[model samples]
Target: MKPTIVFDLDGTLALGDGPISAYARAIATRIGDDSFGERATVALIAHAAGETSYRDGYHAVATLAAEDRVSAEIVSAAYDDSRALLGTAGATVSPPEGLSGFLHGIVEHASLVLATNAPDAGVTALLEEWAIIDLFDAMHFQVGKPAGLVPILTAALARGRVLSVGDIHEFDLAPAAELGADTALVGPAAARLEVPATMRGRTIADIYERISGWATSAPHTAS
Candidate 1:
């Protein structure tokens, strides 16, 4: 069977201009200013860092919003509304070049799974908008990249060599590497974290020349 390849959604397969901007705009409009929106984002991120678990992280952000009298229902509504608007308009989304062809070429030789920090509903909408949902074998959401992704992939695919393709080094590549999965860091820049030399076996730049070589060399028949 073909090797299982996992992907990060935002800033990897899809461009990164959806919910964040919408949230900021909504916050600004609601509070009658932009400063409050910025503060809310900063506070939300800070809250996320103090959590011990994924559920904790989610609740932390929810707590902040609640404290500010921001209704959870409203937040959820805004997210859905923004996603629907973007899906139909496609004005805010930028599809990465070569993504369709790349996926198409390897669809016959590999299993593609999307692993992302994007919210479940939003991710689903984005996939539908891009018309690429059928390409993936499975998807994991709001899990913050490869930190717990190796196990999820293992469970989904049974047994196979795993390779992760993503743009974020810390969230998308490092943890997968630590879990014995191959990693191809997509962007041109190096990671802020210091990757150990031994763990560097599968690193690659997001260039066609390099990608072609890696895809061809990794022998696997599509299941």
Candidate 2:
């Protein structure tokens, strides 16, 4: 069987200029707290993104803004509102250029799966918008990373080799690494995490190129 490549949706396959910071701003706006500025919001999000649960990130934000009476419920509401806004308004989020072609290049040699912390509807919408939904063989949403990766990794490993790719090292790559799967960390911040990875790059395109090169050079064997 071909190796199964598991991808994270938010920052890996989905390329964006500053969606995380933008999301932070939205949360701050919804909370109506002046103290939760974009910088602070970004910091909180970044910290949470590294954790096992997405809620941990939200809780951290609320705790950091306790002076403003920010609660987990409030943070949850803000996050929902931000996602709605991004989905309806077609915010700046988008897939990388030539995404379809990139996927096509590897589809024949590998099995593709999408695993994300985002809601299924939201991820589906984004992938549909990008016209690349068909490229994936399966998808698992709201899988709390670094912890919830077991089931997904177990399933993927049953098929063949596994390669997990994502932007955040701790949330996206660490669990896969622990499960003995190859990992590709795609962003500068990934370097901050002490996890071992098979590849590290600034963008999904870089990962694609590397995988493509490997596929081309790898030795072929009869089934």
Candidate 3:
């Protein structure tokens, strides 16, 4: 049996907006005015001012949802709409060379999965649009990665070994580490995050090369 590999979407699979930023702009527009750009900027500024928690920065925009500027229904609609936007928003981005091939290769060697915090329906649409839905065997949704790391690892290990990869170590790798799963950190560390000495995981700057190695070594096949 091959290892099970759990991957993060956003900055991990493709370059795109962070979770907070994606909803921030949309929620702002629905609340303030028809001008999404301007309203988003204002909400972002307020968030930077420490008016709200970073994870719920969109809440700052939601506050304005009570205004007569737009109906609450419109504001609620923005949540799903914004998530769909993240799918096509990063099209011009140049994926790491051979990234698709790497992902395909990895899928062959392991049980591949997408584990992200994104709302399920929206992220599914995005991955389908990217034409990478087949590369993964499963997809885990909102609030699943950090704390859910143990279950993922346990299930994956039932078949073989497990490797967890993601953009934010604080949100992705720390919890995986607690379960003693191998880890790969994709992006920069948070300002307040501490790096553990003798970390069991590896830091990977290139997702393609890493997945390629895993693919070539495992025993799996993909459509």
Candidate 4:
């Protein structure tokens, strides 16, 4: 059996601001603040540039909403609303440019897995729309992360080596690392997430060659 390479959904694979914007709209509507979306977008940019302390856009917006005294009940409802729009036209989700090609190139050497805290919502449709659903050997949704990832890693480890990749260290990479799996931390959060990642980069594309090296355990093939 091939080694398993696990990836996170959302910012880690599906990239765009639609989902964030939707989240902002929900919070702003609840708080009656129309400018919340713009402010949240600005904060998201800052987070990506390593200028903010947030883990990512969702975290920034959630924290801001809380600061505004939005109740937990309202906050959760807003989040659920945004999550329901994931992978749809409202969410504006799309794969990183050329990601499909890179993943396909390495598919033969490794078994790819998609694991996320997200509900099944738009996941299947999004993968189908991207025309890359079959690339993954396994798909796990509603994974609680940081803790929920332990069993998945354990199973993968039992088979062979495992590598878990995600933008967030705490939710996506830490547990895997603790279980002795190699990890790749990607996306904006990676800049400030000083975790023990076997590979880290600001974007998936930035570490393509490195991932390929580990996947093939040989010289990386041409991208």
Compose the digit string of candidate 3's lDDT tens values, residues 1-223: 7677788766566553344455655665555645654565576565444353433334445665554465677776876776665545422222344566666656767788877776675566666666678788888877555676567667777776666777566666677667666666554332223555112222233445545565456322211
What's the lDDT for all of these models? 0.57, 0.68, 0.58, 0.84
Which residue pairs of candidate 4 clash? none
Which residue runs does candidate 2 get wrong by more than 4 Å? 17-22, 41-69, 87-90, 191-194, 214-223
RMSD per candidate (Å) reads 7.2, 5.2, 7.0, 3.0
Best model per lDDT: 4
Residue-level lDDT of model 1, residues 1-223, one tens digit each, is: 6777778765566553444456555545655666655665665455334322212222333454566787667666654555545533432655676667667777666778888776675567767766788899888877745456656766544666677767566677677666766666543223333443222211232444444444557522211
| True lDDT of residue 118, candidate 2 | 70
Clashes in predicted model 4: 0
Which regions in candidate 4 have their CA more than 4 angstroms from the true location?
Answer: 218-223
Residue-wise C-alpha lDDT for candidate 4, range 1-223, written one tens digit per residue: 7888999997888887788889999888887898887788888878768887776788899898877788999888888899899877777887877898999899999999999988888789888888789999889998998788899899999998888889888888889878888888888767775656788777788888898889878332222
Model 1 local distance difference test score: 0.57
lDDT of 3: 0.58
Better of 1 and 3 by TM-score: 3
**Per-residue alpha-carbon lDDT of model 2 for 1-223, expressed as tens digits?**
7888888887678765344444556667777756576546665546545533233333444455665666767667666655665544434566766778898889888888998887664667777877788989999888887788778998888877788888777777778877877778775455455556777766777667776654455322211
Which ranges in model 1 have alpha carbons more than 4 Å from their true place?
Answer: 36-91, 144-147, 156-158, 187-205, 219-223
